[model samples]
Target chain A: MNRQFLLNLRRGFLVTVCFFVLLGIAYPLAVTGIGQAFFSSQANGSLTKNGSTLIGQQWNGPKWFQGRPDADDPMATGGTNLGPRSKTLVKDVKEQIALLKKERITPTPDLVTTSGSGVDADIAPVDAYAQVNAVAKARGLSVAAVRHLVSTQIHPAQFGFLGSPYVDVLQLNEALRTLR
Target chain B: MGFTWTIVAMIVVLAIAWRFLGAYMVSVYEGRTRWLSYIERPIYKIAGIDPDAEQSWQRYGASLIIFSGVMLLVGYMLLRLQGHLPLNPQHLPDVGPALSWNTIVSFVTNTNWQSYSGETTMSYLSQMGTLALQNFLSAAVGIAVAVALIRGFARKNSKTIGNFWVDVIRTTLYILLPIAFIVAIIFIAQGAIQTLAGPAHIHDLLNGVRQTIPRGPVASQETIKQLGTNGGGFFNANGAMPFENPTGLTNFLSMALILCIPVSLTYVFGKMVGHIRQGAAVLAVMVIIFGSWLAIGAVAEHQANPAVAAAGLSHQPTGNMEGKEVRFGDTSSAFYNITSTQTSTGSVDSANDSYTPMGGFAAMTGMMLGEVSPGGVGSGLYTILLFAIITVFIGGLMVGRTPEYLGKKIQAREVKLAAFGVLVMPITVLILTAVAVSVHAGRAGPLNAGPHGFSEILYTFTSVTNNNGSAFAGLSSNTAFYNIIETVGLLLGRFAIMVPVLALAGGLAAKNVVPASLGTFRTDKPMFIGLLIGVIMVVGALTFFPAVSLGPIVEQLSHGKFF
Candidate 1:
């Protein structure tokens, strides 16, 4: 048993080192090489002209179509883990609604509530359409044209039955730049 | 409709893959995947292990513990020295003492309950080297141990189970790595990012404001993160983060990855034991419990969040949206979170803390059921088998002398070991929870007040004790007190249970098989499945019932109308 114990230690040390290199170093580097080689844009975070279409950003004014209300800070992507019974959550939602009331068009639930990742990149189509009037009013473009732009930017669920159909706010705002 | 389809899609995918994956895994463990054993041979040469060596249970357990201990130290030191390590583009500083200890234990045990956010805390090297490496090894550890236990049943009066070194290496090289590689690239193609670059600094072209979006080798880490049931996130938001999970398609695929190994492991269990029905019985128990929990989670999240409703909006038709993504909506988020918790993969697409009281209950209770409804890859099969042993013992009590399962007699020693294995989780949970809630430090952990606050404390202990890494997230768990307590829980949760399981495996493997008789309690039948489920549910609910009432249950009764 004593000799077996000693042998176990030796094997453990050598095996641990062998695996750390094989799995830790070699595997990730190999995957990264493939990612950079082929899916360069997506692998590099799908970085669009407006920043990565994956991360939500703060929009200061109506010149841009706003993302979710509490969408800010990518330093640590997190959510307001407020309970459904949390008064703090209620107060925050009410404040968000008040903020949305001041904007043009209708407000949706997703616009009023924060996303699981505080940096959500997408919002429902209705939420985007709600911001069309404000974007049009701020840019001095016709609301019809701004709505058309929002419509064009909408991405349906992949493969018809996968995810929710929505629009990426960053991509939409970048597209809105082309409108007269 | 989306909810119904999501369930159907998940069930269909798992049903298609579980059998083939199970058969393939059996081959990997049984050493039939020799085509690339050229790769395995060199690893054995380096590790000084013989490919043909088999171990008694003690030797196998000793090797397993020693390997984990050395790796624990190595991982701990890596995190401490991460600031000075290469590939640290963010140049993050060393992890503090408490968090480092907490994190090493968490990863090494495959619990992956992150006390710190990933994008902020981990360097690229640390993410790739220490944490992600543990993701592979720890999961392999689980599969290895599980295969050893299955050997306990498969062999008759066998002194030796399989070799620890060979089982782990083969499982990783043949099963985990090959599958993870494919999944990682697919994840990248589906928009889950995989790059060596640091957090990207890009300006919003529309607004001219700069934001530093976090980036890493996320796709690689993520594939195993779900596939191995490790649940450690590359970012704080975990699966919710777009770069980590990407689209809804990726979301569905992630759930499939999490379920495939664990779900298929039942078939492996069946195939190894020489009777397909025996394994199929286990699979049925898992399916029933998993399906029931899925229903609860989906239905609970489908209801309009009371707080969201009380806040009053003209258009509040969509179900609970707080702490959930636009793409996942409510039902899909609940589906992902439930799948995660049910299997000891605590990764979340939505925040558990933000769910309706009942939705939160479903996720939390899944872990309280000991995560055996198609649990973690290796852990779940062994855990359910322990319950099976206990069930046979009960049957033995009723039927006079014989209480054999698959011809293995349920002696006193076997019964005690099984009881010891099953009891440790609840005992750890109760003790730590008692410590946390009574102390000021534990009291400070919750982010909300009243019942919700109480739920956070209970959830922390429950999650840690079960080694299910998903948190209520509302818990401020990074404190020295929690850091220390959680470490204790993770160790006791994983190893304490693991040692007894290995011992039980040894005992069973050493025993002579008694001939099957009419008096024997059958494990392969629907009746045995029902008994096994009853034992798990009763034990879980009875143990945690008092504590649970203070949290989600009470909050639900109050209709989320309480403070």
Candidate 2:
């Protein structure tokens, strides 16, 4: 029994050391080598650049768009963690509505509601039409023209089949930048 | 197609390479053991010092703490030296002092909550020496704890548990290393780049300009990354970039690799505990939860918006393809989301922020539920055990008997520890979310409108507290305020749960293993399995139901066509 225990102990120790050396050390080294050789940009965080100025990676979304009204930092991707009845959220929504009206852009359902981090609200897509009218009236344009712009500019579905018709805030803002 | 084949080939080669590596270690160790014993035959070695001795909870805990502390210091120093380090062709900026502290703590804690992007911030030396080393050690720590727990169940009145250093080393070498090696080879063949120099060169057709892509040793990190379920990426783009994931097949394979060890460990649990049924029950619960989330995400992806349909765009029969890699399609992307969320591996091929509200809800809930559906390496098993303890406690309560789990009595102390382990994350998340929404720093981040924007804030807190590093990628988390709060959340989220778990293990170690009787609840039975699943869901529901209904459910009702 004593001999057996010793043997098992020695075996376990040897196995453990060898395993770490290979997997922990060698494995990572080997993989890093491959990543460096082939897919260089991605291997190095997919960083983008323009004349020596480093921009964000293409994979990460930019935060300068109209922004999700639910959370504070629109540039950082995450949820608000607030409930629908949250007074703070309601106040923010009102402010957002006022801001959208000021910008002369109609708000989509996705634009007004809380998502992911467990807050709910009672805004619907129909609200978009109301916002469009509000924007049109403010812009001195016809409601139909406002509606047409909103519908045309929103992000269409994947191959046309996934998600509600909505505008990507970033794209819209980019277009606005060009308009400016 | 080329990408897909390359990925598949990578998976196969990784598996084979790991297996061979394991075999080699086993042989090498066996030979070493023979020589050591031959030398020690005349002298009696204390069992405590003996590598062969069964592990005790005390020793295991001590070793784990010491080893982790050393690694933390080492990783911190590496970060400090990066600006001056060699192999830094880009002359990348040095890591700031505060951020360096945060990074060290994050990696050591296995949180991998990165404040800085990889390619832009870290040099090659920093990546390999600090970040990569921590990846190995942190994962090794998880494996060590798991082995200790398994040994607790396996042993009877043992004075010593396993050697923490030995377990960490062996697990990394035998399990993680071999697998990683094989996977790296396959990844290389499949189109994953492996090199020691600058990034790949690509010419832009639109601008007729040449760009130098950043480069590093990615295959090595990617292997343990997924295997250990530590989600920090070599590049800030994570798995989404073509190099990191590369193709549809590689995506699937990487996803599988991330989940494989955690999933298989259930079988290992059963093997260790001498009960396959018990393992199956745990696995079944995990599969059920995973499957439900996948189905929800897939359907949500498949159901394109009415506006898009009106505009003549349609999602393929497979599902929604927006914000997803076309190479992998909906099926694979949806699967990736579920797997990554379930295992606490945060790598993503699609933009999670772009997922439909309902799909987003499922992903958030997956993380919020403590991610115990076969969670992170070592961490997952320990957490599942916590669930098991709770399940048995509730079972005991139902039958008006004293709670017992795996032959040990589940006393108040154990229950408290388990509860603390489970509840801490939610409490931290809720508190932080409340503070963020109520305060200026927190409220200043959203880029969307109204409740959905609020959900983004809440999701950030949830993901951070749960130690699942994937973000909605829609929030602006680069500010000083976010950096501080998130680092705090990550630290507490990891240590708070870990401390309790280790304490519970020690508590279990002290209890005498009770003999089984017919009246004793058979943990392996179907009824017990149902009870376990129920306990998990109920705890989740009770804790998150109100918050969830308020977010996704309300948002969907308000915005969804059916509503």
Candidate 3:
């Protein structure tokens, strides 16, 4: 019984060692070599560049386009941590609304609503008609015109199944940039 | 347009390949042919560690502790040397001392709770020599523990479990390495970067601007990183970069690789234990849970927002493609969400923060459940075993017999140990998240506005404590306080469960194999499977339901009512 246990132990040990060296060391080396040979750019770190200066990767979203009011500092990329009900959020949203009016751009619902991160301090579209009217007047557009644009542009439910209609601020900004 | 179907087809093919190809490899390793003997001989000689030595569980446990401690020291030193390191042409700044220690402990534990950004803090040397090495070994440790557990079941009255060093080495070399290599080659072919040099040659785009693509040895680390379900990325953006996940195919493949080993190990467990059906039952439960999450994520992503519709944009019935790789599209993004969260692999092709509220909730819940849908390579399977034990015990109780799993009686000791292993993370995650939110340091990092903002903090804690390294990205987690708190989470999340799992293995090893009889309750039956699934759900619900209600559920309800 003792001999059998020892033999089994040896076998288990051998198998485990063999498995590790092959999987851990040799395998990683081989894969690294292969990756080096072919997918050199991506295998490195899919870094994006603008001339000699390195821009962020395309996959990482840029914070600048969503307006100056609640945009995160590019250096930090961190949130301000203000909840929707916080007085700070309300104050920031009002200031952003006033700033949008100064730009003469119609305040889209996305611009006024809070996004996933509370830092941008945007106002939600679900706010009453009065607020929409207030935002529209601030932006020098009629409430009806802003409403029509929002209604036309916002996304609806998926296959009519999930999620409510919402606008993406970045995309809206892209559209605004193209407007004559 | 057909990107979604292409992704689905790719996933199916990869799954099939892993099932068959992995089996063939294991069989080859197990065979005693003289020609194949040469392959493993050199590895045995170089390490100066005997491959054929037997070890008691105590020795195995000791080696695990010692090796992990050494790795932690090495990883910490590597981070400190980053600015002056050979591969750091970018001359990235050195990591802060406190954050470096936290990161080292995180990866050593295989919790991988990175408080520092990958692109900014780590040079190529740190990424390869330290972070990537830890990714491999930590995964090996997980596989080692799993093998020990299997031995406990397979042996009738074994005095020894297995050698920890040997298990770690073999698991890395034989299993993780080969798969990672092939996957890396494929990824490079799909435009993943692989280099030791700085920026590659510049190319002018149609817009008349120059774009110099940065290059590195990403494909190599990426392969094992995903395969091991070690979610640390070479870049801050993670797999979202075109270089890391250039095409839809690579996205699909990465997702498959993350899950492949964990899933195949189920078959391996069955083989080792001489009970294939038992493995299949566990696989079924995993598949069901994964499939449900995938469906929910897809539907939630696909649903066009009413606000977007109001703005006159075309609602693509396909899904919300915002902040997602257009090359991969929505279906693939949704699939990525499910796989990444389910497996504790944090690589992402899309911005999870951009996911819709309910969609984000599904991902968060997947992490909070401990990502045990075949969790991170080694740890995932063991956690599932904990579930299986709980499941089998309940099954036995229902049938009016003392519970037995794989010929070993499931006694109070086993139950208590397994339960402790399974419950530790949920407790730590929820409690820490509550404390963080209430404290000044924790509540200070929200980049977005609303309840979803709060969810980000909660999600970070959940991901860290569960060893599922993905973040909501909106939280500023690079602070000293977050670094310390999350590192503690990472430590407790890993060691707390691992020690208990090892103890359980020791307990099981001492037991005699019981014979199957007329009164023996078959664990493979649907009734038992249902019971097991119920136990998992009930335990999960009981542990995390209140936390969930406060974070995602409340946010979702508030969004629905207010919006």
Candidate 4:
């Protein structure tokens, strides 16, 4: 009985080791290699550089369109769970609205609402459009020119239905920089 | 509005998948998928696993433990060595020893309780290679064990259950692979990122600040993570992250994937035991409990945070929007939170810690109910079966007769095994929670104190020991102390219960089926289902009530009254 148990144990151990090498080491390496070979852009973090600076730019400058109000930590990703009834949430939104009004831009609801992931890369169409004038004026550009550009940047709701239509804020901002 | 539609769509998709997937699995386990033998034939040959050669329960149990032990060591080594490996575009360091120990045991035990954030701590190689590989293997292991238990009930006067290796291989090839592959493709199509890319460095010309956007092979990892009920996310924000979930379609799809196999396994159980009604009965009980918790979470979350109310914000229209993704909305987030916890998938779309005190309670209690409200893939069915046996034993004692389940007499040995399997989780969770609170290290972790603090500590032990993997998010669990204690919780909670369950299968397989008489209890009847649920609830409630009282229960009462 002991011998049979031992034999099964040994075989089990051997199979585990073999499968580990096959799956744990070989499989992911192959997938990673293939991903890099074919989709190098995506496989390497989809990095798009403007001069030397990375995105996630502070939008305090009027030339930039803000994405969402995320926490200060770059690595951290999650929303402020301050409920609708939260005085803190109300205060934050109130402060944001006052600031946006000071810049002479109408703040959209999406601008004030915290995103599910704090570091949301996209903003609502209304939010983006609201900032067009501010951005155009900052760069001494025509509103029509900036509006056309923003419209081009809007990625339609995924497959046209999954999520709301929005534009990538960094990409839009990058486009603004290149505009004459 | 999107939340309501998503819920309806999710129900419709699950209802369809349950019938087809359930029926498909019946054939897969019955060895009827010969069309795939071309692939599996070489695999069986290399592994030296004879598909037809069944082993007795002792050998089967030994085989499982040995394989898990070996894989556990392999997983540990891989995590430790990931810093030197390729595909680490971020140059993330090797995992610290204690964290590595915690992580390996978490994944190996099928718990996937992540103390560290995936995007920061792990290389792409660690995520896809060791963690994702175990997601498939651990889930397959669970299904294999579950099938063995069913075989025990199906056969008469037989010492053998089934071949563990054959069961594991076939489950992976036939059930998990096809579903995960299709879902992974769908995720990619829906904009969930599949990349080998390093973290993105996009220049925001306006802000003058550099922000590094993390990227990874998210969609591929996500599919199996949910499908296998292994809840560890490639990103720390988990399914809530845009790169991971992306849209409502992916969200609905993920919840469905988390539920599909476990729900279908009920049909597999019924078909194997020659009674489809029995499977339906069990599934009904699971759905009832799960739906109740989901509803409770939604209502509680929508009621507004009282502390927020006292602070003077009123006229809220979207309900409690705090700590939730606006894209998913409050109702959907609440549903997802409850669904994830109840199913033991542990992948959260919303932070559970930020939930209203009662909302958090609803999620935690789902795990405390032994997570059998259609639990994680195989664990759900087997745990419920254990409950069924206890129910029968109780029913027998009340009526003065030897209890029987699926024709096998419910002898003392079987009853003891069932009791052990059911009681082990609660005991571990309670004891561990006690130890954690008593020690300075344990009390030191929670971000908040008072009852809410207690809830965080209690939730960790319950989540880890149950192999559920979701966290309250308020606990600072990355320390050496948490890593070690939670490692113990995951290992003991998984293997300790599994050992007795296999023994129970062996014991049942050896017994002859007794012919049904007037005194025999009908387990498939509605009355029996109620009794089984009653037994499950009573046991769960009685065992963990004190902990609940100390945590969410008191926290809820203390809300507005004190806070």
Q: Best by lDDT, which number? A: 1
Query: Taking candidate 2, what TM-score does its chain B reach relative to the real chain B?
Result: 0.88
Q: What digit string (tens of lDDT, one per residue) describes model 1 on residues B256-349?
A: 9999999898889889989988989999999999999988998898888788788886345668889999988888899899999999999999
* lDDT, candidate 2, B253-305, per-residue tens: 68768767766666666666667566667777776777677678767755653
- The DockQ score of candidate 2 comes to 0.06
| Model 2: CA > 4 A from native | A1-180, B1-50, B53-55, B204-207, B305-319, B560-563
User: What DockQ does every candidate get?
Assistant: 0.78, 0.06, 0.11, 0.28
* Weakest 10 consecutive residues of candidate 2 chain B by summed lDDT: B39-48
For residue B169, give model 1's deviation from the true position in Å.
0.7
Rank ordering of all candidates by lDDT, starting from the highest: 1, 4, 3, 2
Kindly list the per-residue Cα lDDT of model 4 for residues B246-328, writing each as its tens digit: 66678778888998899999988999999999898998889888888888998887876565445344444555655666456
Query: Which model, 2 or 3, shows the larger lDDT?
Result: 3
- lDDT of candidate model 4 versus the reference: 0.79
Which interface RMSD values do the candidates have, in the order shown?
1.3, 11.2, 9.2, 4.2
Model 1 clashing residue pairs (backbone): B346-B470
